[model samples]
Target: MATAKKKIHYAWWTLVALCIIVGLAKGALNSSAGLFIPGATQELDILTGNLTLYFSISSIVTMIFLPIGGKILAKYDIRSVLIVAIILQAGSFVAFGFSNSVWGWYIFSIPLAVGGVFTTVIVGPVLVNQWFKKKNGMALGIMGAAGGLLGAIAQPIVGHTIANDGWRAGYISLGIAIIIIVVPTVLLLVRKSPQAIGLKPYGADTASAVGSDGAKEELDKGITLAIARKSSAFYSLFLFFLLITSIASFAIHIPSYIQSRGYDVSFAGNAMGAYMIGVLLGALVLGFLVDKIGSRNTVYLAMVLAIIAVLALLLATDSKMVITLATGLFGFTVSNSVGTLAPALTTSLFGSREYSQIYSTASLGLAIAGIIALPAYGYVFDFTGSYTPVLYVILVLLILNIILVTFAFRGKKKLLTQGHWN
Candidate 1:
């Protein structure tokens, strides 16, 4: 008798683990923070713009720590680093429960950002790059989709919890719950690399040896961090990071934006749920598109989708259908720019030889956008009593990103001609 064998790749297991770890951190905790803002300010009598300063403070900390954190990840065990990261990130949420003063957020934002620099910014792409040589773009997309799926579930629950129990209980309960779930998963599943498990990366048997770093190799396929930094491609990519983040940071303000249009919190919650659905769909579609069409083409398509989303919001303010559709479209197209576009762009531009170092350094734009853009939007709304001006700014930046993408690829061609991509 012949027996059938079941086969499943360990890489997929690692990806699933990441989906949970990052999903809870980003989709649950980070995504839900905006829901807390309204309640926190109303109860504490703080101004919206003033309270948002804590976000900027967190961004500043993230900017300072990203490079340092990349080094730490390369040195430490993934399990140990992530365990500590979850504690800091989730514990800060628990601490926010007791906060009466805005200074508490400022104080807590330090550890929060420190932890987030790893869990949110650095870990996913670094690990995905090391694990999957094939379907790398698709892997990044799945991670984004997971975050969206989890966030879709979390947004409404958090909103309902805040509406019923108040933000204090909501914060403490959600924080503690996430810590309990994520810690064990990290301890059991996550590893720094396929090599640590005595296995080559997924698709290793058939793929190029470009990543293996044989001692006798005469040339490298990717540029070094030193070379990458010196090129115009680097700056253009940095602007892409900055501009995309600045545009997408509007998601954090979606609830506020909806309310300003005379919608209720429940409607805002539903709109966010729709947005997460868009994220889920967009992540998958963009990931597949990048694999089929390449990163450059996928980015052009995402920007076009973004333009339509922004225009819908501008022209159709009176219709609930239009607002929800626009918001969902915004989430689908723009939100994944940081998660999927940034890492994939890094690979397409420079290859994966110095991926961690180059990606981390380039991602300073992400942190810088948080510090500058997030609060700037809040302050703009505070001053003008509308998010209208912010939308105009985002539209301009989207157009500029299209131009920047063309320039970055031209620089890559320059590097190739110079024999730097050996």
Candidate 2:
């Protein structure tokens, strides 16, 4: 009798879909926003601070939507939700091109944030958890690295487009491209659960078969949002999100920051490309490190890199190479705030049970950082005439983040001792 051949797993396909969708969502739409600022301000005749407040508006919308977005993801069809989210998110990017005033950005930022809260902030972690029963850290890292690689490509393309055709055309073209690519990927590849295809999650069987009993117990371990809310683990994770994001918020200002230091827009764009390369390498390294060395150690090392990057930026003078290298290192280390770190940290403290709710709730820190940090950086530049202060503040936050990560793990040990994990 002939034997049937084993089929390739669909989880890998789902990962590819996420990589494309999330990568484009972040690289083409979110990161590209920085490139538009100088040109947009000149044409619209708006102050930089005023133009960037749209980020604040977007953040406010994200804060309101994140919890609700979690519920929507749970209750709605994954394909349908993603398709509509792309339209809303990318469509807003296209709409920004037609606007002649800062108010346009302010208004459209709502839909942008509404859609982004799902696509950018929540979907990758949630879907990875539902699909991958092992190598979860590596999977998250790949997702982030994909964003970095795509962002590397998009950054230059966006800069060239703006330089040649203006921000208006750049925005419209990028939005159209994202919708075209992401919609089909979402419809064809993304599934809510492995059960939809009558298969167990990738690596689920091996994870169970090879585990020590302690490992099995930990897999069964988790706490509800109610319990997590009351735990120090949750709060420490929240502050981690907040501080890390506040630090990473500098990316949006990088174009302006470098320009202030005497680099041109084209050079600034190239620096961002370098930054993306850092993101790509850093994401992969951190992912592997999380599995081998653990999240806490990985986090400590990342924070130290962040401080070095900050110091390089602060002290480096007139050397474009030095500034660019510093910026790249900064991007590599700080990108983890939203990239692998959030999800990895979440898993370390909370386990898998009730993950979606806890992750979404913890992500409020992300939204809050967007609200306060982005605009604050912009306004500080507006008033103080330099980004110098911002760099110092980022360095301080990086040090503090190491402490927060330590406290968070300690909190997890308390939960374990208190029977919360049982």
- What CA RMSD would you report for each candidate? 3.5, 3.3
Candidate 2 lDDT over residue span 1-422, tens digit each: 13332666788898999999998898768987888887788787788889899999988888778779999999999899999998999999999999998889999999999999889978998999999988876787788889889988888788778778888998899999999999999988998899988988999998778899887677767877788899888999999999998998889999888878877677778888888888888888887788899989989988998899889888985888998899889888888656777888999899888887898889889878878898888888889989999998998898889999999999999888888875
Runs in model 2 lying further than 4 Å from the true structure: 1-7, 74-77, 134-137, 191-216, 222-236, 346-362, 406-422
Q: Which numbered prediction scores highest in TM-score against the true structure?
A: 2
lDDT of 1 at 344: 86
Q: How much is the lDDT of residue 41 in candidate 2?
A: 82
lDDT of each: 0.86, 0.87
Tens-place lDDT digits, model 1, residues 1-422: 13322456678888998899998899888887777777787799877788788899988888788779999998988889999998999999999999999998989999999998888878998989999988776787788789999988888787777777888998999999999999999878888789888888888765675545572243345888899899999999999999999999988888888878887776777778788888898888887788899999999999999999998888888888999899889999899887777788999999877877898899888878888887788888888989899899889999999999999999998988898875
Clashing pairs in 2: none
